[model samples]
Target: MNSLVLIAVGLLGILSGWFFYSRFIAARIYQLDAQFRTPAHEFRDGVDFVPTNRYVLWGHHFTSVAGAAPIVGPAIAVIWGWGPAFLWVVLGTIFFAGVHDMGALWASVRNRGQSIGGLSEKLLGSRARWMFMLIMFLVLLMVNAAFATVITNLLIQFPTAVIPVWGAIVVAIGIGQLLYRAQVGLLWPTIIGVGLLYGLILLGNAVPVALPAEIFGLSDRVVWVLLLFLYAGIASTLPVWMLLQPRDYINGIQLFVALGIIYAAALLSAPTVVVPFINDQVPAGTPPIAPLLFVTIACGAISGFHGLVSSGTSSKQLDRETDARLVGYGGAVGEGMLALAAIVCATAGFATLADWQAVYTNFGAGSVGAFVTGGANIVSQGLGIPAGLAATILTVTAALFAGTTMDTGVRLQRYVIQETGAITGIAALKNGTLATLLAIGFCLAIAFGAASDGTGGMVIWPLFGTSNQLLASLTLLMVTVILARLGRPVVFTLVPLVLVLTMAIYALLLQIGTFLGDQNWTLAIMALFILGAAIMVGISAVTALRQTGFSLLAHRHPAE
Candidate 1:
């Protein structure tokens, strides 16, 4: 298990697939027409559907897809040895994720930028539209909860994280004001923003103020959770271009820079890989690859949440059908690369195999966070920075990344609630403000319970993967249904559909067993949620098959 080899394999996987297959081959197979009426044209609006440069759209799409999931997934998957993690990520991105994302984009373009829920209704049924939206709402709630826990922990663990976190917000505000209000172009402001943000980072180090070490007479984790939801309440209601999009752009740049620094460190150190491929010695009842792997590693491979971004926000901004390949397919690959970079940092840059083993053995599966933070410290140390400051900055960056994820999850949840209200004839719930408030309440409740139990850390990893994979499964199902309606080759959609379903079902079963065995009240409640998801998936699949069969029969006969 050579760490460098694993890194090389990951890089090679994305590069070869992106260039040769995704761009050249799959792009053509989709037969995306340049002259087609895109959602930008059909639903032309200033906010969502607007023709824009492909690169800018790529930035938008990439940021929307890249989040804590990628980092967390690879970090946890490394626990099983990088072999399984690397294989799943590389192959999963190439075959399952790339196809699912691109297909969603294509379907949206053809259907005038309708969301996955909308598309499901058109192709599957009106019932499916509601069912899908409900699943999405639950998925997002879990996502928000998990991410909140991760970011909150990081922020508390390292006081230095506040610097980059605040720096990002300040930078976003300046850039957003310039672009939206002042009507200034993005180029100059972006450059200035990055520089100013970096300067602020230095200032933060010079004048570091430790956060009040207590809140609500609870641990820092509890206080952080409360503060995060308070932030989410305000952030989710704001315009995307204001804080979300601009902040994402800044984060995107930071992510790229961090990745470069990490890769450079890995190249310099080239430490041997100590984690074994199959730790047969792992204790029984040690939840390694069963339920944990599926949820823990959600972002890098397949995320149903990506579907929400694809159909919800990204589709509205698509300028052309061809750009879908770049935005959708390319975005997934970018995330996969980010995950690979994390793997390299975790595995290749360790001082020694013994140290890596010690961290894992001592910390158990949760070591991924410390591994990454330590890796960042190693890079900072190599760069001659004081280890304390370096570690602090790294922790803050991770926390900020997690915050972005939580914010996005909250926003998506609001959308889901609104849509659900609309379908359920709940007129009072139709107001965007009310829906948003409801979302905030739900998020806060989950966060509160998670924090109070001190099991917040425990839930984040396992549920993260299951929720995300289920999202992927639903996305694939919707895409398959729509592709079937379009009269495309069913085989193309079938392969990914089956793959997602299989992984999701297997993961869900494992989750059910784990939860039931644990017998904790929270675990039991979550197990019910997992069970419900399994049922929904089963019903959705059966419904899709029946509808496809009926459509085929109708097509074959002139009259029924």
Candidate 2:
């Protein structure tokens, strides 16, 4: 199929889901009442609980969750063929991911914007809360490790992206300072910020930055990783308005503009997908399509991590209950759009089927590189730009995507740790700086220590995906419980909950066996632990559902 045709159809399907199906859930199922005062109103503080513009909040939620995972997942999963990957991205986003995100946000908003971990104690008892938070902590660790490796590798691979990626952060800090400190109007300042960012991209191409052979006797890649984590520590430590929000909003705009250019180029060039619809030419030792694809494409379709962002930060800033549907569900659909663009670039970027096969035959950090190269090639071919500069732009885009997620993951992980410490009565762990240090330390250890190849991102991705989806399943269980307890119909949340729970368990079990066979003892043990936690959480969910009864006419609604 032609890339443009595929894109147009995918866009139509997503729009239909957003306008029709999502609207039905919001109005009839979720019953989002605009009259309800949100947490942002009740806890209106300028630090973490400020009331936000719905549009800017959506941008924040979307970019933070969208990350490089969506691109990397679909980029790799198309190994099964573009057909299955595209199918899951479209259907999963509308049915599973969208519902999960909306339900998570809704649960948090009604609970005074508590994290999902916080809700577990109130809804599922203290033990289940501990188990859920433990799983979340591990998942975020993997996220930080993976994204740090990803960002470092991208900078090393595309040296031109180095300047632009770093420059954007500096510019974002300035934007935040002007907006929050100087009281400048949003429009002109934002336009200037974006223009400067693009200008850096061009200037970076002209004078690409390359590291010397050694930086204080360490390899450049290692030094880059260290610098990245250091930046993450400082950036994630600041208040949300100082760094995360403004930076993500700018990156979100950059992503949207890049998407427009890519699709317009595809429409004009009409690139034929050299990769087949159903690829049968699987190389030796490649995992089967069933469970692998589900885990591989976690964020593009449905991600549990989105639950963390929704409940962790987004819910805390929600201005009205009705905006939950728009920000939560809409942010997920926006991620699906980004995933579709990735699939297009991955499947059509190569000149021939063999070229596509060569890159995708093995799964690793390089899959992201493939997407960047292919996307740059496609846009360059159609728009008549230099391939090198185009590649630099896409590389910087991917780095920014990964960088935002890394910063946010560290912050979220620290919060989870501190919350866990508070619940467990460990006063020392509750210190913010100490918690942040612990978060960064764990990530660095996993990224540099356990990864034999030093590309921790690829190795831990399967773990990340399984843990991420399992967390989503657990989050959905909580969402189902909240709905049941609220006297609302539970079908919308219940259905996806069951589906993700089943698939994630199946994948985790399969991964456990695979890791055992590969002699990857660490992952095997981790997978087994997550699976055990899931079983416990699942038992609790089933017990709660039976007690509450999944009826639309629930007579005993819990206190809101």
Candidate 3:
């Protein structure tokens, strides 16, 4: 396929979803009202549910939703061929993600910004509330662990990355304090932060840190992972206004800027799309089309994890129901654009298929980071910057991006564990600090296990996708139940509900089988989790069907 045509198709997919399906859902089914008082009004808490302008909410929503998952998933998916990867991204965003996000926001709005867990209980049953929380905790733990490894690996491989990475963190904290505590507006702080961060990058090249070949006789990977968690722990403990929100705003802008540069380069060069639409080179027994592609590219298309962000953080800040369309629907499209950029970078900039394959073989799992850094290098070359410096800057930026994701993942995991403990009446686990520590411990254990296995834990990628998708499926089911209760049209909710559940279950089964055969402790733990998820989904589906049937019957009979 021609590169330009492929790129156009990807953009068209995003636009179609944004304009057609998302708009329709926002206006017709959700019937979002600008006049209605949102949860931000009803709850009115300064922390979570403060009323904010749609623009500010957009910043929050974008940051919360955009993370390592979108980048990592697309990078891996492109290995199969950009065609299937791009197709899933486009179609999945339109039908699956748009629906999932809009539904979550709508449900949250109706329920006064109560989380998905609470909404599930109100709509599905008390059991679903517990199941949702449990699944969310496990998923967050895996997300934190996986991205923790990814970030640490990148940092270890490129020691110079620490300069800009730490600089960004420091600048973010300063900006956060200025904006929130010092009563300074966002304008000055952001401008100053960006400038300072760039300056730090230049200085970093002058005086780079040179560590011993090993730290404490441990591999560089191990040291990096420990430092990353330590950083996450501190970041998570800070007030949202002071660190989390400001860092997210900076990261969000950087993401867009990087994307613009990459896209401009692609269009100018108009590189050939060398990757095949369907590669016969794919190893046998790998289902090239349906199940594997669907699971592998989960985040770009329709991440269930987005549901957590939508309901957990973004929903609480929405100023009105109408804002849901912008935050929920628009956020998904933004992520789709990120995925598209990854595809373009992987395909368009490569000189040939041979070069692409060489990078994949040489860098191994690090090919995605290398590809992106190379893209940055190409842009730098085209713009007359030193390629080495440019690549180092880009690599550091990617590391920072991954770091932010890990921070949020850790916090989400803590919330999940604490909430689960509360619901389960586990007094020992109810302390927030204790729960947070346990959450971190769980993630560290997974990372250590994966590292020791020497497989680099690429096998865990599919499991992450499955867990994320299942979360989305469960969220959709909850949305359907809520709509049914609220007497809204169930057709929209029902269709996507079935689709996500089917995809999630198929993916889970594949994971369970793979894990069972592996028989390792990590895989075994994953298998047990998958089995529990399977049962929860089955039970939830049956209950939802029965509830829908009763609603239909009652409507027809005008119940006595």
TM-score per prediction, in order, is 0.89, 0.96, 0.89
Instruction: Give the per-residue lDDT digits (tens) of candidate 1, residues 135-214.
Output: 77777777777677777666666655666676678788777778767988878877787677667667766766556767
Candidate 3 yields a Cα-based lDDT of 0.71
Steric clashes per prediction: 5, 0, 0
Q: After TM-score superposition, what is the CA distance of residue 210 in candidate 3 from its true location, in Å?
A: 4.8
Clash list (residue pairs), candidate 1? 161-396, 295-465, 295-466, 304-471, 304-472
Instruction: State the lDDT at 512 in candidate 1.
Output: 65
> Which run of 10 residues does model 3 get worst, by summed lDDT?
551-560
Candidate topping lDDT? 2
Cα lDDT of model 2 by residue, 1-560, tens digit? 78888899899998788999999888877889999999988998776787776766787788889879899999988888899999999999899888899889988999888899899989888888888888988888888888888888888888999889999998888888887789887886689888999999999999889899687778888788889999999988887778888888889888888888888888878888988888888777777888778888988799999999999889988888899887989988989998998999998988888888777766542368778889988998899878998898888888998899887888899889889788879999999899999998888777777664345655666788778888998998898887887778777777777777777888888888889999999889889998898788778877887787668444455644
State the number of backbone clashes in model 3.
0
